[model samples]
Target: MNASPVTIPARRGKAAFVAAGQSIKVINTHGEQVVDTWAFNRADITEFMSMEHTRSGSRHIIPRVGDAMLTNHRRPILTLTEDTSGGIHDTLCAACDRYRYEGLGCTEPHDNCTDNLAAGLAELGLTPPETPSPLNLFMNIPWTPDGEIAFEPPISTPGCYVVLRAEMDLVIAFSACPQDLLPINGRAGKPTEAHFVIA
Candidate 1:
């Protein structure tokens, strides 16, 4: 493990390898930025973390500490070991892509999580077979009993974080989500950087 925390630059992505039994501490540095997270088997990128599989296995919309995040093949890849960020995270939202921004009326190219994931993996001379739905950390998406959900500012405070233990040797990736058009990042509509430390 490195002695220093690594930055997930604002509106960008970062990835690293985590051996089985290692834990990653993801910090909500600014209290507002939502980090879209993914994990892939070190030996086979095609067998990546699957939020659907995890949800089915855990039987929860929002994973709690102790929940095992499963891979596409129904194997445990990561486990939620600790959470101090108000225990709010999303398991249903798909990573943002160019089409997402375009639908929001952006005429110019936007930095998005899908592209971010590819870029992060590319740095390690790796590539994901496909973009999977991400575990959105510190994201606030409240739902109604009737099934309606709305994006809202995160309730987590600065310096709060969550720790996830790797159940298998894998590559973990993160994106400091850049959704300024919505308050998901914050009511101020500003995106910020986050940090992570492996231990």
Candidate 2:
């Protein structure tokens, strides 16, 4: 009943969409970093989220500890419900925009992550935005059984956050990943804020 105070800067990435009463919050003011999330429906987006139908219906596709970021038609777009990094977070990991710019070597234009996802999908108005397929919240990317997926470190810290309470009507987007070559934005990256609640 008290979740509001979003300072989500530090290599930022932001997106919002949560109805059915409403709820959205993300905090990690400093201490490892990674925030990427996407849950669709918002009327319908070709029944999105089909990473091969979530690894063939939840056999395994990231999100550990009780896992439930379920999708791929199974519904329920988030259910890790609460975690403090213990479960780690990151669905494979994909947030280094500008064509991943030489795999994030840095050209120094500032405001990366596809410009915070085109300003978080231009606040839903989408002036010049039309690119979907996302869901990253708290990126960690660590899995190498030869498949490969390095980019580790950063399971959230500084007031870690992860809360979801919506079962329908959603269209989330996030970017808290302005990457300067990447370190989960902890090298000189700063400036973040996101807060919303409606019980």
Candidate 3:
């Protein structure tokens, strides 16, 4: 059973400290919302989740059930235990940032996953890396036969979720991606609630 869940508001962020053996379930309260997920060792924030390590260790661009999310030290930080989102998560893309939107022709500032991550980590008395790449949950970025990667709409629907079991004490964070400039969020760009349940 899940513990009480806390909703991470759309275009915002949230985090929690999870003990080893505990798990976190990220839920798409509304369809097509992308959640940028991150994690760090509770005892050492510098040893954070590393997508490169994960892909190298698991030998998959997109992680499958039973794959482990590796840390900078190349140790399992979390393991994918349950997935109901059709494996639409992405690893190739970096988390959106203010500059990315500006380059995309947005003259104004925007809410970004990178900033969200830092803010959330701060609440736990931790600081993230200067540039933090995350496991983009519900994002659909596929590679073509030509070896080109294309961003696409998410395959996740309302109520879809993915659960990860903590392999060690961790500070887990997530951002309900606020990128209104991409189709990854179904072109709505509008943020939606993401339920984080620790069990």
User: lDDT scores for all predictions?
Assistant: 0.95, 0.57, 0.89
Query: Model 3 Cα RMSD, Å?
Result: 1.4
lDDT of 3 by residue, 20-118 (tens): 999898898897899999989998888989999999999999989999999989999999999999987998889899889889998878898988998
CA displacement after TM-score superposition, residue 15 of candidate 1 (Å): 0.4
Q: Which stretches of candidate 1 lie over 4 Å from their true place?
A: none
Candidate 1 vs candidate 3, TM-score winner: 1
Candidate 2 — what's its lDDT?
A: 0.57
TM-score of each predicted structure versus truth: 0.99, 0.29, 0.96
- Candidate 1 has a TM-score of 0.99
Q: By descending lDDT, how would the candidates be arranged?
A: 1, 3, 2
lDDT of 1 by residue, 57-164 (tens): 999999999999999999999999999999999987899999999999999999999999999999999988999999999999989999999999999999999999
Off by over 4 Å in 3: none
